[model samples]
Target: MPPALTSGWSRVLQGERVLGEADSILKFVPYSDCKQGCSGMLYVTNFKLAFLTADRSSYDNTGKRNRSKILGDDDIPLTNIDSIYTVSLSGKRKKMTVDSKMPTTETLEVHCKDMRIVKYGFKFAPKDQNKKFVNTLIHHAFAKKDTLLFAYEYGRSNELKDRELICDCPMFDTIIDWEDELQRCKANKTWRVADVNMSFDMSQSLPRYFVVPTALMNNDIQKAASHFSDRRIPIWCYTHINGNSLLRMSAQDSDTDQPREVSRMLDAVKVASNQRNKPKIVKVEEKCPSCQEVQESFVKLRKICMSDTMQEFSNQDAVWNTSLENTRWLLLVSRCLAACNEVAEEVTGGKRTVVIQERTGWDLSCLVSSVSQVLLDPHYRTLAGFQGLVQKEWVRMGHPFQRYLSLVTVSEADTEQVPIFLLFLDCIWQLLIQYPAAFEFTETYLTTIWDSAYIGLFDTFLFNNDHQRYHFSRNEGKNIKQFKLPSVWKWDFQLGSEDFSFFKNPLYLITHDEELVSSLNELQVLSIQGMFCRSSRNNSFTTSLEQNRNHSQDARPERIDPLKKDLLVPNCSSLSIRLWTQCYLRWQSPAQILSGGTPTQYLQQCVMVEEIAQLHHKLKTLQLRESLFVEFRSKNDLIVSHQPNKSKISELLNSTALSSSFPFSPGPALKEKQFSFTPICSYIRNSSLDYDKYVDDDWTGTL
Candidate 1:
């Protein structure tokens, strides 16, 4: 390779071997954004597809070099590529699929899982080099073999040892982790941790150790597990304070076989819990939105999100409301939320054990089970608890991440490609919006997790099951280098300590309140009544909210103490289910504001909240001291007296909130010490101030 092909800016990671390189590759920007193309050198490595410009400049939408040098805007992990299409630069520029014949093309369009569209033109390159580049990309990028993935190679390397330390998430990777979780939830009395799947002989999908009802013997478990698909037995996911527990399992493999053994398993679960009522078997396939339906809705939504031109976006915008409805994404959200609420009610109020049953017990099962826990158990609402919940419910339960995420090309049909996890995140976002103070984590945390899913380095979301992960790491011979795969829970690897601080919700308080339950009942009374169905007459997302509200007005439940009640259900009505614009539309330059967007607003709020907390602490200290005199003319005077110094606020924000990565950065720091304190003081004064004009001059900008 010549010096021209060698990259000065982009460096390959340890164990990341470059297979092919092509120079004079023209990296094309969207015509709506920029007309000119930049010449670059493209390299296809085992780990990633890296593109380095000759000038070594990778700019953001703001025309600033804001991206990191190692994995800049043009560099995409091979695992992130969703699909690839080819276009001719010579003639009509018709896009065609990359088939076995290796079609001659001048431009290659790469669509990524992260919603990034990167186009590279080969018009100036030699035909042979172009063909080689295309071949290398297709062969390695879409390789079905698990060993070919970077996780194994990188795990075997020395670099990962240092990188692994930054992750702070409790991986829930050991049997002890599950035991600890069960004890935390007070579930150890009814459930016992078993290593029935120790060698994966019982089930390939299930983790080695999991909790099962203590009443059942190993023989009974083995007999019962044989009946269900992938041996996804009714395992304990969560247990409420009321003693009713949440369980998840797959439907029986043969419908005609009369699932007598499975019934016995359920009986054992009920017997162990000593509940008078029978367990509620929620057929998730029947109760919630189907994976196929979720996939269809996501595809339509993605097409709308990836609009290439202003004209195309406008065309979609004309019927944007209808388009969103047609996608049925919100409808699916409503259904999932409704299902969670139903399960939560059963487990908490009715004291009935709820068993979530699906075909494979991973996709919808994980979604419903996880969401219900977040709603019913206040522990899961905390940041650490939420991570553990995901680890146990989703990762340990074995949601087919490789297939659902489209990490690698499975088949031509793209059969299992669905955003089930994304849908779960969106549903959580809706809850976070409705009850902002309830969750310990911010929306930025959820979005960051979604973004990290495609990074291809984490072992957390790489495999379909513990079996696959085990096999991938297991080296039979001494000659083979053992692969080290770290958990995605170690978030420090993806974000710095300063950036990670943004994940903590400033609004969250340590004390429980009655408002949560009161709001839940209020929202439930106003919620739409029906589950989402695909009939033409029944498909309108918002049609039932008004009718339901009127009918349920007289049936509103009396508010109770939140300490006694505890659970907080969301208003999952169609109108309440919102599009997560911060996650989906963050990339569109037209959608972004002049200053920082919601993240900046959040930063300002965070700073003010911190100041208020300090003030409260001071007041408590003053009370303890029995101060002789205190100055207070009016509420306004009191607030004004304690208003945070502008310089202090600026310095505080710059050091913390403003240091986050793109899409989350709070923009530039406040330069002027004499800046207006109106926005910061608005919350204290209860002012209905319009800060839009002050925040951004271009307030009329839109996508």
Candidate 2:
């Protein structure tokens, strides 16, 4: 059991040895008088001994006092010491003569100001040894000086326990456990432990103050108990004593779901990274120029052939290779669909659909197997499918899955499946136009097919639409221009306008000094030129026929002679003149000549004659035309006096002097009247014609 409080104080005052080395001092000074009339008191305790200043003041002293009386320690209490300073005065001071130096020691001063003291109620150490008991006793004896006495604890815990005392001075405030108070203050965010040890003077430095959780007694406590640790601080323990509970509660209530979500997000990133593969270009030579041209010439020809084949199959007159062409329509539709899917996929981010129109001629039955294959693969199954079933009978007519299987079988069996493949592409394109949603889903699949097959065929397809407007060429003997689609056709499809008003509208009229349509496919341009030449030839033939008819009815002898020659010899000269006339007419401005509306036969003949006369005059100015005019002696100048010879006609035909010569071989001519007028008809063999002077002066001198 613990000793009683008064007994502990008495033991300490008796100079009993205490535990541990005494490193600190506890001094008490009293100023006020106790109820028993004490004046002042002083108490001082060291490691080995305790001492006090004796009270010596006289209450009945005379008013006039000498210096010696005043200087006496009369008011000093037994507990109130004037000063308490450490002394190390051991051994006698060494004396030195005039030649030797005296030993000296450095002294440091400490000043205590504002020394107002309040009494404390409980003491952890003994006083009087109760400094308060001695102070009260001394204060009653002296009345000259003021003193103050306060309760304080000093020394280690063992010493303090041994010297326990109950304070007799008036209690000002309860003694607080400073460590616990600091913990509470830290927990409430009201106080922080500050180390007051750092000072400018080396001797004045104090120990560092540390803040920590109350649950943590040592560094190992924080390590052992998770609840007593702080996550934010570098130290393993909480700096403030009261902060342990808050940190523990926070850790206990934290949610664990965040890491899982983060993990899933990371997985998604990894999957995305691993999924991508490098793209490669694949070459497919499916269509040759001849096949492409034939297809173009016969627009929707496959549909016509399918209808014919189906009709023949229905007739059943003969079982002659019925199934061979039976699946042609289906094959074509599949190819069309493939092409459309590929294009749509490229345009959209794998979110386009392919829609095929539901029609009897299309024969979409081939797609069943293909659709099934797509359905089998979980990823691609959702990517592409087929729709548009209007008839109950045809509900399962075109299963894409079945068609896909057929395609695989047919591809292995025959190398000439290109036409069928193209048809499939067409079907795909039609599907894209019809079903936008499905097209979007199958966009990636479509893109893959297009990259493999359709990319190089773009120009060929455009040239097929309007070959006369485009030009094509090959690079390294491979069809490089095959993908060069016409700008006009491309614009039509891209704009989704069949009329192509964007190119033809007056508001958007395009103009140029000389517009060379560079993007035109070569085949298209050649086809256009062929058509123009054919039209011109037909017009010339018709004009010659009309002239022949007109001359037939004339009954005149000269007319009869010409008609007889035309019938008998079929004059080459007549044919050459007719061709030359046509060429001239082609060069004439349509606006100027056609503005007169449709002319009569006679009027047309007159216009032709006049144009020929003007051409002759122009050629003569250029030294290209020769004239042979003569007057007959009589209207019927007696029977063939002078016959026009073949040499004269040959000379006229061989003449190179013509305004514009033909570029082909010339033919023979026939004699006409005695006064013969034969215009020169020589071929213009030059590769290039110089019409620069006729157009612009910039080319004047150069030509």
Candidate 3:
């Protein structure tokens, strides 16, 4: 028979006291040993006492016992007696040489009433067979009511070697179930009701012994409770560590009689679970460029998702064709940006022009395109990627629409318009910082075209629609009322140039008010000069009075007092002289150097020469000028030399006279004496006026 089955017999024999002797009698043996008849054996017998006299030999100086006390026969009464039998034997034998010549020892049996061989075994097999011993012990313990305790010495079972001696010798039985629940509780270091029940009930001796499976002990309290109730076992649930009762019941109790305390305990567990299961909230800091606002706050994810307004705005289908929530979100963003702009404006004032452009939606292709040309540099590419990530994250959260709309509305509604403008300004600033030369080139191109063209167009539109005029009648024509129109000077015409003759003959000098003209001139000069210097120098310069120059025929000519110059060159064609003088100053090397010319100077000079060449060519094409003649006579002797005067003068100077005479003018001639000579006398005399010398010296006699 198996050791487990035999152990059960021992358990019945010992009954309630089985636990006391369990440690000694139940020795586990291996299955392999049982097959070989090498299994361990158990001895059981009725109690018998005996005493008998025996002779002893005296020992001499060795101080050693010559003979030990022999068995003495005596009679003793036995209070209890039980049947003795070989319950079980199983185990293997260790390797050893058998000698047939040596006498084999016989198994001995001693009679002891009230003694029993409840179980006995030897673990002589390989290490793997130890589980069988544990199984036998468990079987024995569970078989009989008196099985209070079970124990295996330190070296018995390899599997149970490190584990604590499992003592099921409880005063009462406790039920537990739910395999995973126990594991969870154990992992969390939590103590549940099963632990309480075992600790409380087992401390008492009412039932003497309790049998529980290790699996049951580890189960969840709730599951254990159901299992226990189904089995109709009285259970006293208690906490693991303190043994405090969570619930208590008798096997016969109705469901209504279930412990109220159990409900409380369950509730407590739920509370703990709720806390453990809760989602965490985190705070985020977002900076909106459009509204220039930084938002630092905490938001619950669920709340943000569930907001009706947000939902409405974010909805794809809406009458407004835009998500109202998105619009509001954008508005909020705009508000933030506006706030930021307010701060910026407070610091920078309205001197700076700001414009902000917000990109929206997942189609980063556009943003990528817009910034692609800009992101040629690795650094700009990195920045763009980072900003793109930020934008993408916002979009993922469904707030992209909100942010975009907020930026737009706030930008638009901005009375000062700083926030809206500042966004673009900052972007430009960033772009310039990232790619200075590229930004500069791009700005130059834009200024060359749009600044003038679009700005002019806007100005025209603004001026034409300056005022909103409406007429009202009181009492049906009893009285007519008129109000000044609303005017918005969108473009400052004062800053425009009259030379841009593409439009109506260039309304030069508009608004006859002298102060206004002066102001306008200053403004126009500033715009032109500022833009020109910036473009040419590739640097920014401040606009101020000190930086301006006075020039009569430059783009912005100095205001001339027409009366003053008329006296000096009365018939010199004042306009022509002024224009010629301006050209001369521009062409002079020293003046050009003083003006800080560069290789570009030659280019500018070439451009001027080209213009003059074109003008000359045009004049020639129109046949505007024909040859004019000037006649001169020698005041020297008229010796009747019939020289063809023109040919003679032409021969005298080799035609240089003809070429130089027409182009030059004679100034007021020096005072000269006239001489009269008789026609009959061929007299030769020196002329007082030296016309040849004068003509030769002064290319233009005006000099």
Q: How well is each residue in 101-164 modelled by candidate 1, as lDDT tens digits?
A: 5667777888877766777878888878887888788878775756667876787784466465
> Which lDDT tens digits does candidate 3 get at residues 287-403?
332222312110111122221122433452244323233223333333333333332232122222111112221122112222222222222222223223222222211122212
Shift of residue 141 alpha carbon in model 3, Å: 99
lDDT of all the models against the reference?
0.68, 0.23, 0.22
How high is each candidate's TM-score?
0.79, 0.15, 0.14
What TM-score should be assigned to candidate 2? Answer: 0.15
Separate clash counts for every candidate: 1, 94, 43
Better of 1 and 3 by lDDT: 1
For residues 531-649, could you state the per-residue lDDT of candidate 2 as single tens digits? 53245322532334233332222224654433122221111121121111111111111111221211122122222322223333343344522434322211111011111232332
Name the candidate, 1 or 3, with the larger TM-score value: 1
TM-score head-to-head 1 vs 2, winner: 1
For candidate 3, the TM-score is 0.14
The superposed Cα distance between candidate 1 and the true structure at residue 446, in angstroms, equals: 0.9
